[model samples]
Target: MEKNLAQKYNHKDVEEGRYDEWVKKGYFTAGDKSKDPFTIVIPPPNVTGILHIGHAWDNTLQDIISRYKRMQGYDMLYLPGMDHAGIATQARVDARLKSEGISRYDIGREKFLERAWQWKEEYAATIRKQWAKLGNSLDYSRERFTMDEGFNDAVRHVFVTLYNEGLIYRGWRIINWDPEARTALSNIEVYYQDDPGKMYYFDYKVEETNEYFTVATTRPETMFGDVCVVVNPEDERFSHLVGKHAVNPANGEAIPIIADSYVDVEFGTGAMKCTPAHDPNDFAIAERHGLEKPICMNPDGTMNALSGEYEGMDRYECRDKLVERIKEEGNLIKIEDITHNVAHSERTHCVIEPYLSEQWFVKMKPLAEDVLKNQNDPDQRINFYPERFSRVFEQWLENIEDWCISRQLWWG
Candidate 1:
């Protein structure tokens, strides 16, 4: 009490004391590889992040398992690393420069990327410091970054080998585009929200007839590239116009009425506009009809030349203009605001624009087949937590798309 020099809790005083002791005791070091081996890789965190609650929880669990393995006298390796999250890291650096009143373009790509590497080094140092605090028994001596030369070489080697095997390809495909990032994203990166919006109805004149059929759609602006109108072949309602075409409500472009099983007979009058350039399902229909797939928007979700007067405008703005134009043409139908799940880019957080673009992809059918076969035979299978997630895993494997693997950015 005289000096207030000694505290009741000496944890802080023993901080450096405990860490050095643990490391010196070889608790953090790996045993000889000759011993019965045990290894658990510490999941690499995104380079753009600091430790959060989820990281804290996850690392805590890993630490417990590693400690138990060491006690069991197993040679162990818990290697630590960071994932160079391309878009996320780029966005973080861009944001930092924005605060400093500078732009990446002003600094040039090499310089900007050098700055990003600096940020990564700082964060890596902090991560090492934080992991120390958490007592994670990760082998920092062998730490790796996903973007390091050796890792990059491995990535390139895999890519080249897969491409040579025809398991990789580049082609025109329908993809969910991130406008703000101007990049093609894998389907897994898309997040959905229930959005409240109106579906617009427009009248289409039947070719060689004065009568017109109305279509109800949530995305009216995509009418710019309508190649056809689709309905179920068994749909008795539109059977009369089955062999004919329709005059586009706004552009007067004639598009044939085609029957396809993809349409659900009960949804929105059972009549759907086929805009191959803007919808995935419609792209399939276009291929069937040998329709020319002209793109109406850029990867960044801005209007392109196919949009005519709406060219260069943002997609939502063009949507408004298209609706107004149809209204003026006396072909506009009623609109009702409704809630629905809208998909957005996970990186840019912009509404996902379905666009036709050239991109690199991975053929996944064989990979999925192997996963499914293993999953179906439960005796020799991996696992899922909570039990319910097992069904989700199975479902995902069943419907896995060809993975889009390219990014316009350099750090991927």
Candidate 2:
């Protein structure tokens, strides 16, 4: 054996069959009742695709900890698993079907689900092979899938328990909507980017009087939903305009001029259009003032009946057409080009609409409060590394809103 040493090591020769041997010996399995347990559950990789370098890096760290614990005579159970990845998996399957000139809709629910399961199996096998090649010391005997029977039962049990406890409720609320996906997204799922846009200043004439107050908006399309024009109560310039009604420049509809401190005194002629159904801040103002919230856009981002003649048109298309009409009617004051932040869906990459919809929500504030109390307790405190992260976690928890727990997707 000493006479034939290769200059470069052959990893295949050395590593082949080693992991199988380790598994057969039950080295990575943890069934011992005597030794103290040390477990690390893999943050299940998505079944939508093959694992990448990120997965390798993450697994390597877990593998190191698991091996170290095993060496220290602990009953190590490095559990392995894969996620069904609800939306992500469904998107992948849909894309695949589209390539074959057919859609999931054409195939129907049952057939479409069969394809999704096939995709899961294919990707899960690839991931398992990847983990083996990486020499991860995982307990394959205890492997799990998110959609497995036991996991489904566990999820249902928790959901029902939360519902019974009054922690979960269904109600209408403003949410980030993905038009392309036809689903509601959580706030974190919408990312903002600076986009070159136009600010349109238009005249809102006082009803039954020649007096006019100018208002500016970046989204002229949403003007059809405007319930009121808001000005700061303390602003001397627009104090006289308060309590008067203004004609909506888009359709000559009467909208009240209201005073609210939420309006920025220096921005856009100091007047803000309140579209309660389409804007969160406006919705809050509507709640305080008892103004009606009327939705102007359809779920698919088309103008609805509330948009009048602009109905059935895309929101942006309506904007272009309405702007032209406004200018023709002598209501358009000016247009200024500027860059502003626009929210876009993380998955679909389409512009995210602030949509009002009825959906399931989980009360998160109470849960967050409990977590904060536990974190501050000396006996039960969970330690964080790079300790400054504790403040980041605390800050996020302190401002946590109700979590939207439902999606308009067939999967998950």
Best TM-score goes to which candidate? 2
lDDT at position 277, candidate 1: 74
**Tens-digit lDDT string for candidate 1 (366-410):** 888888888867796778788899899888888888999987784
Candidate 1 wrongly placed segments (more than 4 Å): 1-7, 16-37, 68-75, 98-107, 375-379, 383-391
Q: Candidate 2: deviation at residue 260, Å?
A: 1.7
Any residue pairs clashing in model 2, and if so which?
A: none
List where candidate 2 sits over 4 angstroms from the true fold: 1-3, 17-27, 33-35, 98-102
Best by lDDT: 2
